[model samples]
Target: MAAPDPDPASAGDGPGPVALVIGSSAGYGLAATLVGLRTHRMRGLGIAFEAPETGRRTASAGWYRTARTAELAAGADFAFLRDDAFSDGVKEEAADLLAARFGKVDLLIYSIAAPRRTDPLTGEVHHSVIKPLGTDYRAKTLVFEDSAPRIGALHLPAADGAEREATVQVMGGADWQLWIDALQSRDLLADGFRTVALSYVGSDITAPVYRAGTIGAAKQHLEDTARALDARLGDAGHAHTVVAGAAVTQASTAIPSIALYTSILHRVTADRWQTPVDQAAALWSRLTGAAALGLDDQGRVRLDDWEMNPEVQAAVRTAWDRADTDSISTLADTDWFRDQVGRLYGWHVPGVDYETPAETTVPWPAPAGLGVTTHSS
Candidate 1:
C-alpha cells in the first residue's frame, strides 16, 4: 500500500501521536512501527531483543530490518531499545524515556512472541511448547527434504499439566498487563490512549494442534486480559485483541502445523492474501478514524475476514484432505511458502545482488543498553 502524505496541520505546534511498540524488531510489531511512522505520521519507541553480527556471522534479520526502519524514520521522533522487554529494568527505562521525550504515549502495540520468559517478580523461568492438550494429534505436516517441500504424517504427544501451565506463563497476557500497569503507574498514558495485542484463531483443520492447543490456552488468557485492561482503562483509554490472519512470520514458521496450513491457505487464497504490512495499514486506518472499525462479536478488530471466508475455508479443507506426498506439490503452494520464509531472513529478495559482498555489521540508529536511553532528533 502507498503511504499517505503527512499533513502538516496534524503536527500543530507539537508532535503527532506517540506510540510504544513492544517486540518491534520483526513480524507484526515491525509492520505496526512502519505504519505508525509512514502512514499515521506518529513518533514512537520500539523495543526488541536482537543480536548483532559476530566475527563472521551476519546480524539477525530483525537487526537489519530495524536499521532499515531507522533509515525510513529520518527526521522523525523515534528511538529503539535493544533489550529484554520483560525485565523491570527495561520497562522502567522505557517509561523514563517516554516521559522525558514525549510526555505521554497515545498507543501501545504488544506483539511479543517468545519461547521463554523469566518472571521478574519471582525469578522463575517459564518455557512454552507447541503440543495439543488432550489425546495425541496426528496430521499431515509439511517438511523440507533435500531443500524440496514434502508432506508427511507426524505425531505429536499431548502436553502435560506442567507443560500447559508453563506455556501459559510464557506466552500469556501477564507481560502485557505488567506493561500497562507500569505505564499507568508513571501516568504515561495519554487521554484516549489505545492498546492492542495481536492474536490468531485458526480454522478447525488445525484446531487440534493450534487454536485448541496449549498456545490457544495462552491466547485465551491474553484475550481475557484485554477485556480486564479495557475495563481498567475505563474512560481514559481502551484495549483490544486484534485477531490477525495467517501469514509467514518468523514466529509462525516455527509452529508445527502452521507452515503446512499456511501453504494450503496461500494456494486457496492466491492473489488475495494480506501480508503483515497490509494488515497493519488496515489497522492504522481503523485506529485513526480513516476507515470503519470492523469489530467482531468479541470486540476484536477482525483482519482475518478474508482468511475466514466460507468459500476460502472450504477450498482449504478440500486441499487439506487430498494433500499427500504424491500430490502435495500440486495441492499446496509450497514454493510461495518457501519464498516467504526466505524473505524473512533477508534472502531471495528481488533487485538484491547475492553475489556482491555487502556490509554485515549494521549499527542501530539509537542504541540503548539495559537502562540507557538514546533518541534520534
Candidate 2:
C-alpha cells in the first residue's frame, strides 16, 4: 500500500494540466486518476457508474473509492460524475462540464469495462460475453466457495457471430472513439492532448479465455481505434493502447481463468508484483516525458513487461500445468489473490475498523443526487 513518489518537476506556478478519466472509480482508471492528481498535480474529472448504499446492503466499492479519492484530492480541482458513460446525455454533460470548469482537457484516459452497452446512435443494447470464438473452450479455473479457493474445470461454448459482434460493440473502442469525437467537436481538446485506453494481453495460460477469446476480439478493435485516433490527432495529440498486466480487479474476478492465472502470477512474481497504481505512476512519467516511452511493435505502451517476462511466463505455465484442487494452494498465491479481492470492496484493509458501525451514506463532492457511502480510511 505504498504511495507513488510525487514528481517534483510537476510542481509549477501555473495551473496544472486538466485530465478526464472515464471509468475512474476503480481499477486502472482509479490508479490513473490518482497519478494525475497526486503525482502530476493535475485537475481531473472522473466518470463512473456506481451504486450507493441501501438499507442492509453496502454501497459499491467504486462508490467508496470515489469518495476517498475526493477526500484525498482536498486541495486539487477534481469532480466525479456518477452516470452511464455510454449514454449520449452523460457525454454531453461531461463535455459541458469540462468546457466550463477546466476550459480544456490535456489528457483523456479511457478505461471502462462494462458487461452491457447501449448504442447511442441506434439505441441498441449490446451484451458482452467472455466465451471463445468458433470453438468451445475448456480449462482449469479457480473458484472461491464459502471463502475458500478450489480448482474447478470450466467448459464454455463458442460464441455465435451475433454474440461476437455484440461483445465487440460493448467492450471495443467504439465508445472510446465516440468520447474523443465528442470532445473534439466541442473544441475542448488542448494542444498536445494525449489519450490512452487500457488493455490486457495475458500469458498463454489464460489466452484461450482472455487474449484469444471473444474479449480479445473486442480488445483488437480497441487497438485499431487507437491507431485511427493517433492518425486523426496527428500533431495535435496522440492516442495509445496501454497493455497492462494481470491484477486482481472486480472485472478479473468474474473471469474464472483470469482469477486462476492472476493467483499463480502473484505467487510467481511475489514481491516483484506491481499494483495498478504503481504502473500508473510509471505511465504518468512516460506520458509527461520524464521516463522513456517503451512502445512495442504496434506503437503502444507496454506496462505488462514484467508479467510478460520470459521467466515469469515460464513459471506461470509450469504452475498452471500442475494446478489442481489439492496442489493449487501450493502452486498459486491464493491468499494474496483473496486479500486483493477483499480490498476491492473496502474489506481486509489494514487500519480500518470493520467492527465499528460507520456511516454508510457518503456524498460525492459535486453533482448532487448521487448518494454515497462511508469507507474506512
Candidate 3:
C-alpha cells in the first residue's frame, strides 16, 4: 500500500513530535512510551493487546495506562488503542482510528514479543520452543516463582523450514508492514518521520537460545524489514531497527537462562553507569534528537550501548563463563535487582510518590494473555 497524500501536518511543524507505540502497555514498550512523554516531551498514541480486565496481575498495573493519559493531560495530544495486532480486523480498526484522530504521525515504535504465531501465507500455526541445540545442554535456570535455582536440560522442538519461515512471516515483517502501510494509506505519516523496532543480539553464550534460535531467525527477519522500510522511505524519511540493551523485561523472562544474563547485565550496566533509567535516558535522547539520529554499524540503532561496550561485554562474558548456581545468584547486585523491578512499575521513582494514589487508570483494550491460540488467518 502506498502512503496517502501529504497533508498539512505531514510536514514536521511542531515540537515534541507525534508518536505511536505498538505493544506499549508493559515492559520495554511501556518504558519507551514513558521516556518519550516525560523526557522527549512528545505527544503520542499507544496500542496494546492486553486490557486491564484481562485479569493478569502484571497487566492490571494502572501505571501503564496512567502514564499514557497523564501525558495527554500535559498538552500532548495522545490516544490509546487496544487490539491484537496479529488479528487483521483489529489492526485495521486501529489504523482507521489513527487516521481519524491524527492525520499524520512523526514516529512509530514496534515492541512486541510472542511465542506462537499463525502464518498468513501457509495454513499452519507455529509454536516456538527454546532449548539447547544439542542434547548435552544444561544451565542454571532461576525459578522466580519459587525464588530458587535448579539445573535442568532444555530441549527444544525440531524446526521445519516451513514452520520457521511462517514464524518469521507472522512475528517479523508482516505485522510491521501492515501498520506502516495503513498509516501511510491514511495519510498518517509526516515527511522526515522515523520508525524503529526493538531487537536484541544477546551474548554469544545464548546464541543457541537467542541469537541463532527461532527468535533469532525472527529478529533477522525484523532487521530485514527495517532495511526494507529504510529503502521505502527513500529520501523522504528513515526507518531503522535498534538492538536495545539487555534489560529485565517480561519478554526476557520467557527466554531460558536469561535470568543469569540479565543478572550480569544489571550488575555491569549499573556499575558502569548509574541505572537502567540513565541508559534509557541516553537511548531516548538518541531516539529523539540528542545523538545524531541514524543507524549504527549493524544497520540498526545502537541503543545497546551498554551491551556493546567493550568493558561491559567482557565483564558479562566473564560472568557468564563463571556462572554456576550460587555464583549466578550472588554475582548480581540485589540492590540493582530491587531497583530494576521497582522501575518496571514506576515504583521508587524520585519525583513520583509511590505511596500516594496518583491516578493509575487508563484505557487498554487488548488481551494480556500470552497464551493466544495460534490459528492460520
Candidate 4:
C-alpha cells in the first residue's frame, strides 16, 4: 500500500514526528501507538512478534489490533514490523525501517511483557519468574472459577539462587537502554525525543507478588536505566519510567493474583476506571503538555496517580478485608474485568459483529522491506 501523505505540520519536510513502539500489539504498547498517531500527530512504526495467520489458526490479537489501528489512522502513516524486539539485529532493522519511512523518531515506547529473553551477544536465554524476593508471599487471589468469581489465598514461593537475576535479565531495562543506544548511535533519535518504559507498582496487598517480587527487582533496574538515559539524552531527548494503573491486559487473566487485584481495584476505583487506552492518552498528554513531566521525589513519571489515590486505596483495603469466595462477586467489578479482557480479542468491542466472520489476514506496510524477527538472537 502507498504511504499516506505526511501531516503538513511536521518538524520537517521529511516525515511527521515518528513514534517507534516496541511490543506494539495489545495492551499499553498498542494504546501508545494510537496516541502517537492521533494526539502527537506522528507516523508509527510498531514492533511486535505475532505469528502470522496459518491455515486454520488465526493471527494474534496484536495483529488484529494493529490492522484496526491502520484502518482508523486515516491518512496517517502507519506500519508494523511483526518481529521480536529483543534480538541481536532487531535494533538495526528498526533503524533501517525508520530511515526508510520516517527519519528521526521523536518517541520510543517500550511495553514488552514476555516470559523469557536472550542475550543478543552471548545467546544465553534467561527466563523470568513471578515470585517474592525473600519469603513466601501469601495473597488473596481471585479468579472466575467455573463462571463464578471466587477468591483464594495463593502462597507464592521466593525466587532462589539466580532466579532473581534471571528475572531481572528478562524484564529489566537493559534492552531498553540498548534500544536507545542503537537509535542514538545511528543518529536516529530526533531532538527533544522521549522514551518511556511502562511498569506496575501496586499497593502492599500485592507487593510481595508484584512490587516486591522478582519483577519488582527488574522494575528497579528499569528506573535506574531511566535515570541514566535521562542524563544521557544531553538536551536531545528524555527517558523515564511510567507506572501505569492495573487493567485487564491480554496476560492478566493467566496470573490469578493480578486478576484478583484488578477486579478489586476496579470496584474501588469505581466509575473512574482507566483502560489501557486511557492510560496511553494520559501518558501522551503528559509528554506533549507544556508543563514538564511531573516527577515524583524519585524522579520518575507517575501515570498511576489516580490509581494510587489514598481514598481509592483505603476503600480497596477495606474491601480486601471482606474479599472472600462469597463476597468476590459483590466486592469486585467482575463483569467489567471480563468485558475488558473480551475486548482484547475483538469481543465486547462496540459496533463489531460477534456472530459474523471477518477478514483475518492483512499485509503490514514494509517501507524498508524489513520483516519480523521470529527468534531470539
Candidate 5:
C-alpha cells in the first residue's frame, strides 16, 4: 500500500514538533495527548493496547482512537502502533513505521504502566505486587462510590535473591533506554527534541504500594535515566521526568493502596471542579512550552508536589485510618469520585446516553502513520 503524503501545512510543521506517545490508550498518557492535541496543536504518533478491539467498547473508545481519527480527518498526521514497547523487535517495527510515515519525532512521551516484565538478564518473569511493608496494615476500600466500604489488607508478595534484582532491571529504565538508543541510532529522533516520562511519589499511607514499593524502586531508576538522557541530548536536545499529579488510571486501579488514595482524593477535590486531565493539560503546557519546567530544591519536576500538600495528605491518611465499609465514603457523599469515574469512560456528559452503544464508528481522517484497518472485539 502507498503511504499518504505528509501534510505540509500540518499543525506541527512550523516548529518541526511532533510527539511519539507510548501507552497512549488511557489515563495520564491519554490526558497528555489530549493536551498536545487541543492546546499545543501538536501531531502525535501513539501506541495503545485497545487497538485490537473491533467493537467500540468503552475502554477502546477513549481519546486515543477518537483523537487520532479527528486529527487525521483534520489533515494532521499521526501513527498508532499497536504493539508492546518493552520488546526490541516491536520497538524497531514501530520506529520503522514512524520513519516511513513522518521521518522524525521531536518529542516522546513514555506513560507505560504494566504489571510485570520478563527480565532478559536473569531469564525470569516478575509480576508486580502491592502491599504495605508495615506490620498489620488496614484501610477502608471503596468498591463503588456510595456503596458500603470494606476494610482491606494489602499483602505484597516478597521477592528475594536474583529475582528482586531482575524485577528492578526488567521493569525499570533499561527498556526506556532501549527505545531512546534505537531511535537515536536510526536517526529517527529529530534534533533539539525532548522526552518525558511520568512518575509518582505519595505519602506514608500509600508509600508501601507506591513510593517505597518495588514499583517505587523502578521509578528511582527512571529518574536516574532521565538525568542520563538529558546529558546524552547534550546542547541540541534534552530529556526530563515529571512526577505527575495523582490521577486515577487503569494502571492505578491495579495498585492496592490507590483505591483509598483515589477515594480520598475524590473527597477532597469534589468541590474544586478540577479533573486529572486538567492538571495534565497544565503540566504539558509548561513542559512543551518555551520555558523550562521549574524544578524543586531537589531538582525534580514539582507537578506532584501540589498533590502531596501537607493538609491534603493528612486528610487522606486520616480518612483511611478511620473508616470501614459501614462508614465508607460514596460518590453521592463526596461528588468528586463520581466525576472521576464518569470521565473515565467519557460517559458523564449531561445529555449523553451511557447505556446505549457509543458512536465509535464516527468518521475520522485516516493518516499515513496509522493505517486504516478495523479492529475486532
Candidate 6:
C-alpha cells in the first residue's frame, strides 16, 4: 500500500528541495510532479508538450492541468516549459534554466510517451507500433460499450522487424540518456542526484502482446540504459527504472489486447487500486523512507509488488481463463475503470461543480521575458 501524505494538499511545510521532471503534463509525470510539490515540498521544473489553443479545439489537458496546479500552488516555485523534450535545443534550454534558477537538480523524473520521435541531429523519424513479434497471437480484449465493460473480440496480430525497430526507436531510453548527459555536461545534476524513469512489466497473460512485444523491446533498452547510467553516476548519483503497476494511462491504452486483463487485474487488486498519484507517493516514501533505494533482483525499483502478488496473479489468471463478453462485467470493476478514465480528463471528480460555467484557459509557464512560440495543429 502507498503511504499518502498526512495532508496531500498544503504549502509543503516539509524541507523543500529542487527537482526536474520531463513529460510533466499527465499520467505518471503529472502525478509525480504534484507529489513532489505538495507532499514533499519540492521546487519543480516541468517540461511537457502542449499544443496552442486554436479556433476550434481547446488547449491540451496538460496545459489546463498545469494552470490548475499553478492556481493551487500557494507561492510555490514551479516553472513549466511547453516544448518538445526530444529536441536538443529544448534540453539545452532546460539545462541552462536549471543552472540559473535551481543551481542544482536533486531529483529528475523521465516519463515521456510519444507515438513518434525524430532524431535531433539526423532528422530521422521513428514511429512505434504494438504487435506480437513472431507468430499470430490471439488474446481476449475488453471494451467499454453500452455503459459497461464487455470483453471484446479476440485480437491477433504479428509483428515484423520493421515494427519492432520502430517501437524501440521511439520508446527506447536513448533520449533519457541524452537528457542526463546534457545536464551532467552543464553541471546541473546535484550531488547524490536521484533520477527515475517509469516502466512496466506486466503478468504473463499479455506477454505475447505487451511484455514480450515491441514495447517490451523498448523497455529492455530502457533498463539497459539505466545500468549504464548507474555506472556513470557511480556513488554520487543513483539512476534506475521503477516498474509501476498496470494502470490506465494514455500509453497503456495504446498497447493492444490489455483491456480484459487490466480490468480483471483491477478487480483482483481492488483493495489496493493505485492511481498514478498513489504510485508517486509510494515511490517518494520508498525513496526518502528508512529504506535506501532498495531494488528487486532485476535491479529495478519494485512499485508493482502489490500488483505482482502470487495470489493476485493466480486470481487474475483464473479470471482470464473464463472471461468473455457475457462474464466480464460480472467479473471486474468496470465502474472503477470508468471513473478513473473520467478523472483522467478532469471530470467526475468530487467537490467540483460540473454544472457551473468555468474558465479553462490559462497561460503557459514560459520563462520570464522569453516569448513562447505557439503552433496550432
Q: Residue 273, candidate 2: how far off, in angstroms?
A: 0.5
Model 3 lDDT-worst window of ten: 1-10
Name the better of 3 and 5 by TM-score: 5
**In candidate 4, residue 274 scores what lDDT?**
78
Q: For model 4, how does the per-residue alpha-carbon lDDT over 119-172 read when each residue is reduced to its tens digit?
A: 897899999988888898887876666767777768877889699999899899
Per-residue lDDT tens digits for candidate 2, residues 324-374, read: 988999999888888888998878898999999888788755733322222
Cα miss at 106, model 1 (Å)?
Answer: 0.5
Report the alpha-carbon TM-score of model 5 versus the true structure: 0.80
Off by over 4 Å in 4: 1-15, 350-352, 365-377
Q: Give the worst 10-residue stretch by lDDT in candidate 6.
A: 368-377
Candidate 6 lDDT tens digits, 1-377: 12234454433456566888899888788888887776777775888888866768777777888777655555667787878888898887787777766788888999988989988868999988887788887877778777767776666678889989888888889899999999999888888898889899999988888778888899999999998998999989888999998888767876766666777889988778677888887787766653556698878998888888999999999988998878887787777767766776777787889999767566766544333333223
RMSD (CA, Å), each prediction: 3.1, 3.4, 7.6, 3.9, 5.6, 2.9
Candidate 3 Cα errors over 4 Å, as ranges: 1-15, 54-59, 62-75, 118-126, 131-137, 144-163, 273-280, 334-377
Pairs with backbone N, CA or C atoms under 3 Å apart (clashes), candidate 4 = none
lDDT of each: 0.86, 0.86, 0.64, 0.78, 0.64, 0.79
Clashes of each: 0, 2, 6, 0, 6, 0
lDDT of 5 by residue, 1-377 (tens): 01133334333546435788887767777776666665566665776655433454433554345555455336556555555567666677777767766778888888877767665446566665454333334444456534434556555554343544554675567777788898998998887788888787766777755666666777888888988988888986877777777766667777766766777766765555345466666566567574558776644666765567787777766776676665564422434545555656664557767788755654333465455433232
Candidate 2 lDDT score at position 162: 93
Q: What TM-score, over all chains together, does every model reach?
A: 0.94, 0.94, 0.77, 0.90, 0.80, 0.92
Rate residue 305 of model 6 by lDDT. Answer: 80
For lDDT, candidate 2 versus 5, the one ahead is 2
RMSD of 2: 3.4
Residue 371 C-alpha lDDT in model 6 = 35
Residue 91 Cα positional deviation in candidate 4, in Å, after optimal superposition: 1.2
